[model samples]
Target: MRADAQRNRDHLLAVAGTIVVEEGVDVSMRDIARRAGVGLATLLRHFPTREALLEALLRTSFEELTARASALEASDAAREALVSWVRECVAWTTEYRGATELMAAAIDEPGSALHASCVTLRAAGARLLVRAQAAGEARGDLDGDDLFALIAMLAWAGDQPALAPRAEHLFDVVASAVLTGAGGR
Candidate 1:
């Protein structure tokens, strides 16, 4: 791709990502082009189709999230690190709601890139969970799948702006339950 073409692609991805998160995935491609200061042909040339664009956006986000998760120090205060990572994950989910939904939809589609990314994330999260459990800071019985499910639930709840204020409380409760063996009602 030419330098200008690459710049246009990057701009379109950034602008369209925000628009999709604020609006819905059904937002017009022309609008995306307009916001990106690119022609509709340029946008289409970069993304080809709406699903293609969504998949690319989601893959990029998931890759970034996985990298962040991998960079977290497992040897630190395990409980605190886990809590902080969960909070970060929640923030990402809330900030990219539409893209996340598209990712979920993509996971259900066979041979989708999102499904592959999900698998990678699961493996990395499992490693972190195992390390925390080994350090006796987290529940021994809690597997990666369980942690993933818990985070997904929290992310869904945190997606609502009205529920934003309660996220910390919810995170605390979950952390206590998973780490300290406190019974969460």
Candidate 2:
């Protein structure tokens, strides 16, 4: 891509990321182009599809989450690290409107551009989960997949305006139920 085209692409991605966080993934492409001061055709030339745009917008965050898991392990105890990572996962899922739903779909759909990112996130969560289990901080029966689902549920609660006030309560409940001897730890 030429320098000018690359600049346009970067601008579009940045604007789209903001809009998705404020509005939703379902926001129209035309509106994004309008906000970015570009034509819809130009946007399509860069992203081609809404999924493509979403994948590009969130890839960095997903990668960071994976990296954060490694960093957290070195700094925090097993239980704290797992819980903190769960909190971070919820934050990521709720950072954008409809992100919880998007992540759920992305995790299972092999064809989705965000699928690999989702896989990496699952691995990160699993890494923490293993540490917690080894330390007897989490239930031996629980696995990374379950932890991922827990974060997803918490994020779902966070996204519901009516449920936002109870989001913390929901997180506590899920975390308690998942961790052994935690009692909402």
Candidate 3:
């Protein structure tokens, strides 16, 4: 793609992401085009359909999350590293608001672009969980699916502005319970 075309696509993705988080996935392409300061044709060229755009926006967030998770040094204190990574994931999900929902929807829809993007993050998180458990820093019984479920739940809870204040506390409680079997001191 040409530099200008790439710029236009980037702009569209940014604007579409904000709109999806703030408004919803139902927000029109025309609105995204307007927000991106681009024409409808340009928006369509970048993202042919609502699902395509939504998937692209969500894929971007998930890719970033995977990158962050992958960058975590496994050589560090396993428990601290796992906890820190989870907290960072929570923060990212909270900041992105509707990201969890988008991911869920994508997963539910077969052959989704977002579904492919999620695989790496899931694998990375599983690795972290396994390392933590093997080191006796986290509960051996806690599986990757459980951790993923917890993340989705917490992310959904954090989506509500009223519950936002307690998001960190909630994450801490969950992390402590999962890691220490009871709760962390």
- Which structure among the candidates has the greatest lDDT? 2
lDDT (tens digit, per residue) of candidate 2 on 23-90 = 98899999999999989999999999999999999998898999999998887588989989899989
lDDT of 1 at 93: 71
- List of clashing residue pairs for candidate 1: none
Quantify how close model 3 is to the true structure by its C-alpha RMSD in Å. 2.3
Q: Residue 180 deviation, candidate 1, in Å?
A: 2.9
lDDT of each: 0.74, 0.89, 0.76
Residue 48 alpha-carbon offset, candidate 2, angstroms: 0.3
lDDT: which is higher, 1 or 2?
2
The clash count for each model shown is: 0, 0, 0
lDDT of 3 by residue, 8-109 (tens): 888888888788767866688999898888899989988998878877777766777777666774457677777877777777676665677766665555
| Model 1 C-alpha lDDT per residue in residues 20-45, reported as the tens digit of each score | 88886778899998988878998898
**Better by lDDT, candidate 3 or 2:** 2
Q: Is candidate 1 or candidate 3 better by lDDT?
A: 3
